[model samples]
Target: MWRLKTHMLVHTNEFNYSCGYCPYRSRSRSSLQIHERTHTGDRPYQCVQCHATFSSASNLASHRRSHLPPVFSCDVCQRGFKFKQSLL
Candidate 1:
């Protein structure tokens, strides 16, 4: 599968794409495009809950979690957590 081939590039450190502005290289075309945003100052992904913006969708996804209410709570300390694993 293509996913397996992409995962193999991580172990082999073999990337097919190179950045024109820097020494950065990536196995996927999408990753290279995201990296290029760092040089271009292009933050296409914006948070709907806030004014914050990110160059990549993954970064925006991580930021969006901060706006979410905790789904799990610690029984002993009454601490809140967004994920069940975090409560553990």
Candidate 2:
């Protein structure tokens, strides 16, 4: 199964792909593929408000927060952020 293969890869410490510019390593080929985009200046995610781009979906999600209202407010200062998870 896919889970077994993924676990095997973790145990093997196989880093078949490496970053050319830096010493970044990854166990999965997909992670290496996405990391390579960073060196190549390939940003697939775009922000509509500022027309900014990011290489990963997680980055894009974080960027989108600026456009939306803050979900969590500081207890003392009342400072707001779009993500409640960031409060931790």
Candidate 3:
């Protein structure tokens, strides 16, 4: 039973297959199938704020930060950032 459970967990965690031309990882077979679009340069998500497109949701989230005001500013140069931790 322990061996069977371990094997199942291994299968569940595996995302060993990857696209040869791009960096993308998917644990599920379906997700891997979807991720193959990157190699083809297919971006399905488009930003409503600026019409920018991204290959993945995480990239879209990061891109959205560009539309917002900086949360932190440089004390000496007056440079700003959307993230407070960027100050450090």
Candidate 4:
């Protein structure tokens, strides 16, 4: 007698990666790593100018732009921006 191998279908939305420290779950490994930073208070990304740290790289980049002088100024709100596209 031979045994047949079968596969079961699982929903993609299922929470596979769960946080060991807290009540959190993520579908992907990368998302779990970012979520874990909240509980662990880990800042892998750091700013060069101010020595400030952030959990995400994008947040650190946005913070660095603040130190630069604004080239484009808004006429209505009087908000200064480094890039012109932001005004639009």
**Largest lDDT belongs to which candidate?**
1
Per-candidate Cα lDDT values, in order, are 0.90, 0.86, 0.77, 0.81
TM-score list, all predictions? 0.75, 0.71, 0.57, 0.66
What candidate 1 gets wrong by more than 4 Å, as runs, is 11-13, 83-88
lDDT of 1: 0.90
Off-target runs (Cα >4 Å) in candidate 3 are: 1-13, 16-26, 30-34, 75-78, 84-88
Model 1 error, position 47 (Å): 1.0
Cα deviation in Å at residue 48, candidate 1?
Answer: 1.3
Total clashes in model 1, counting residue pairs 3 or more apart in sequence or in different chains: 0
lDDT of 2 by residue, 32-69 (tens): 87899978999998998999999988899888888888
Better of 2 and 4 by lDDT: 2
The local lDDT score (0 to 100) that residue 58 gets in candidate 4 is 76
| Per-residue alpha-carbon lDDT of candidate 1 for residues 1-88, written as tens digits (9 for 90 to 100) | 9889778888886789999999999888999999999999999999988889999999999889889999789999999998787875
Q: How large is the C-alpha RMSD of every model relative to the true structure?
A: 2.5, 2.6, 5.9, 8.9
| Residue clash pairs of candidate 2 | none
Per-candidate clashes, comma-separated: 0, 0, 0, 0
7-88 in candidate 4: lDDT tens per residue? Answer: 1213445777899889898766777898899889999998888899998887888888888999799999999898788999
Best by TM-score: 1
For residue 47, give model 2's deviation from the true position in Å: 1.6
Give candidate 1's error at residue 86 in angstroms: 6.8
Stretches of candidate 2 off by over 4 Å are 20-23, 84-88
